[model samples]
Target: MMEPIPGESKKRVRAKPATKREMSQFHTDEYVDFLHRITPENAHQFSKEQSKYNVGDDCPIFDGLFEYCSISAGGSMEGAARLSRDKCDIAVNWAGGLHHAKKAEASGFCYVNDIVLGILELLRYHQRVLYIDIDVHHGDGVEEAFYTTDRVMTASFHKYGEFFPGTGEVRDNGIGKGKGYAVNVPLRDGITDENYRSIFQPVMTRIIDFYQPGAIVLQCGADSLSGDRLGSFNLSMRGHAACVQFIKSFNLPLLLLGGGGYTVKSVSRTWAYETGLAAGVELRGGKLLLAVWPKLTIGHAQ
Candidate 1:
């Protein structure tokens, strides 16, 4: 029941994070390169579970695992700092929505929980934080980290029972004092943008209005965008960015993070386009120099 004191954004659309292999505390250098090598064609040669975690079958491990992963974490951390410093209405770290990364393992293509890390940085100052994830997959990593803390509220709207990682059941709400703080709105399969909007707005309004946290962190994954190889939904980037606009409309200290997003073409385009929306600038799209990017900092977090 706390009122939010909105912080300032930097008033600039900063570039993505920089990943340095030397700085990470979570992963080992050998495994980082291992993830990159066992991808796609050679992926089939790996153990089934290894292929599950590697890049070949679905989540392709790329050359920049060290670079991209570190940079993504950096962006999310910066977003948390931006909100605390209060440079603009919203601070976005789209590269930090890597929900699949575990405490010591990488699964579902994610190397780190940038969103959780960003929120943790924010928690250094504020007592209440609201995390809203609108990705196709459940925000398992973020939700798990905050599942026992009332200080943060994680609201994820993702596919129903038995998705990847095989967690996030509706009954999996918060535990101990964190009860009801972890709200899971498991969505149906193959939902369109309209369905997304309908369910998203009301639930978000209800939760944010009731909890009244000091800040909001949104995971607006572009995997919800149509034609994504891994995604089942049919949303356009324009439709997806509407979520960013909605959160910003609250005028709170917000960090717009990114996650999911498989199709290279649509994924990059969608997040970049949404970044324009969060900044309150008109995106000229291949014409103007002011085209902002969206929620890939964690997912694309580059």
Candidate 2:
């Protein structure tokens, strides 16, 4: 099979007509309205560049920034609401993992943090909420937002060592009661899907299950998707989706989040496929999505 060039124009690509469910409203109408007011221009008013907030290139403010971001934030929070209402065993939002948005600033590509909002909403009902981020990029904003809070356990498996945001060293752990709650596994390069599956699922299952978290929010960033333009990890969409399935199989009320995905083709389609898998929405007659990722190497043979 001939592989199409990576990042080449695939606008002709047709995603499997996936539709978004209605997100629950956790934030007050006032807060939601406040978010709607932020535009690319006014977004600068909430700047915090010196340490952990700013309007950088990747997160450049643009028109409709608030509109899309509000929906993203609301959807993930809605997933948490499902867990709270015990409506679904697992809720995944492919468009709602804006992890970098700070309380008052926008950073990384995240204009609003759906994970944080979801966790906050979940906390109202559940005693403990566990957040697991598997983006190749560090889930800095989410970690910081919940750093000192014991209600949420934010565990991140991301690339560190001069990586973007440069937070989440193996040591930062957590502060106060949140100690040991924030676990960071800053993995090195050359990591593959099997290695991730072996480590991520088992560890998460053990910790979350043992902790007996009332709910779980998983950030499945497709930047970790193989052939990624920015992400360093070489995980396949199947492999990443396996983590989602793992959470679902555990019978825990899971809320899936989309954290980071730069390579548009790989990120968009991977999220689409995984979202369909989690939602159990059978995609019929979908166009043949291209897989430009080189056939797996590095022990995928096993």
Candidate 3:
């Protein structure tokens, strides 16, 4: 869809696959080795290894699984590198933002956490980095990784109760020197555009003002849209993109990432629209579309 994006030929660069050493920055050596070694054909030989790494149903073993994880991580790491070097004001990586993968285990269909690697890259050059997650599920792995550090502040707005990988509670603030750095906005079902803005805008404003981050990493998960099969929020395309526009208004070096979005059409439209927003282009008109497709479903690509 972005093939003919204005000036994309000049702006885009092929993301190199992340090396095992690069992935090792945040992943355990045993886990990375297992990811690099295990394959579908050898599944019977590694039953214990699979069970140990939590790789059965949700995070299944497949061909090119390691390569897929590597490429995704590569795209995000490259985006962060570009931003840190001041080569681009905003870098968008729709292939990245797997926030559920821990250091040694996969969760919620995410095998590797590119968000953490990208943040670690940013922290090298920036004094402070702010991570904002708008996914329906909590970004638990990311919050856990930086929970003890004040250098990176994580703010998440997610569906709270009885969700997968549930950990983003409002009271689960950071500890020690990082106290009050982590912000979680646990929300209910079927929240509208106006209602979301009332909370999102003010909260983001306060966070930005207080944190004063050198860079921002935003996980624009389209599952928060109204018709998402795996999500319960009532936000429209405009409602979701509104978050992008507001964040862009900050004029900070931003790394835009993709997270959970199951509805195929909505996910495509939302990311394409948000990409346009990142490029300072308005890809849509005044009104936004809202229609739930019960039949169309893409399994956890985000």
Candidate 4:
């Protein structure tokens, strides 16, 4: 599980771990406390508390759980900060996009809703922020977090009813001031490049026209790619990167984040390809400077 390698010309910014106070921007104090207190020594007793926060099979309590959550959430926060400060036109956080964690609960292998926290950071500078989730499962937590806020518009494209944590429906648009802002494009199984584009392009165009957000956060979940262990879509590397390409065309302040992808090899390849796309590099005909199989190597290619 190596991260995507940035091009040699790109300046890499190291992310700092998110502190408890920083994470409290979106996560509840109690939930954050649980993540900090759970340890191998007290883990057996904590099992009884797991169900309260949806931390069982999907989100098991492992050692260094707090550190993992802090680092993952930290990357998204750093990306958002960079975008808000105009430090970078686009910031990529391959460790983030955990859209399934709620304000006080965990779900779908996500323990902290880093995307929400990241959006909050962007909101500090931008009047409006757009969150687009391309995970196979619905971005229920993120959609819910901004459901009543007009300043943040959330759009999720995912599999409908039969999927895990099923929630996204085309009819479930936002409420109150957020009405007409929450968009859902639920798809069937076996979606290919052409069909996905036919739907993605038009919907995204309409969203951009209507919302005109000052900043955009995209959750590029590799699980949607073909042969993903937990996904049903049939997208190839090119097909998956096409989504990133389309979004990058907007030329707005953008934050790219990683999401669901159980198949190790596919996830690494998809992210690496998309990273090249973000860096304005054409990796198609280039030779592999270093071979790591499931992971990518960081280096320059002629």
lDDT of 4 at 213: 95
Q: Can you write out model 4's per-residue Cα lDDT over 1-302, one digit (the tens) per residue? A: 22345443355666778999999998889889999998878877877677788887878888889998998888888888877886677788888889999998989999998899999999999999999999898999999999998999999999876788878889999999999889999999999999999999999999999999999999998899989999999988898889999998898888899999999998988888887777776676664443222211221111
lDDT of 3 at 29: 94
Please give each candidate's TM-score: 0.77, 0.76, 0.92, 0.92
Over the stretch 88-155, how does candidate 2's per-residue lDDT look in tens digits?
56665666777876766667877666777778888889999888888888888888987887888888
Weakest 10 consecutive residues of candidate 2 by summed lDDT = 293-302
Which segments of model 1 are wrong by more than 4 Å?
1-64, 284-302
Query: Which regions of candidate 4 deviate over 4 angstroms?
Result: 1-9, 288-302
- Cα error, residue 103 of model 1, in Å, equals 1.5
1 or 3: which has the higher TM-score?
3
TM-score of model 2 (CA atoms): 0.76
Q: What TM-score quantifies how close candidate 4 is to the native fold?
A: 0.92
lDDT by residue (tens digit), candidate 1, 1-302: 11222223223444345343422434455555555455445655666646544544445555555566667777777767756866444665655788877654576878666776778778887889999988888888888878888999999888786667677778989999899999988777678878889988998999989998988888887877778777677788778888888887887788887788878888778777776666544567475343333321212231
User: How many residue pairs clash (N, CA or C atoms closer than 3 angstroms) in each of the candidate models, in the order given?
Assistant: 29, 2, 0, 0
Model 4, residue 199: distance off in Å is 0.3
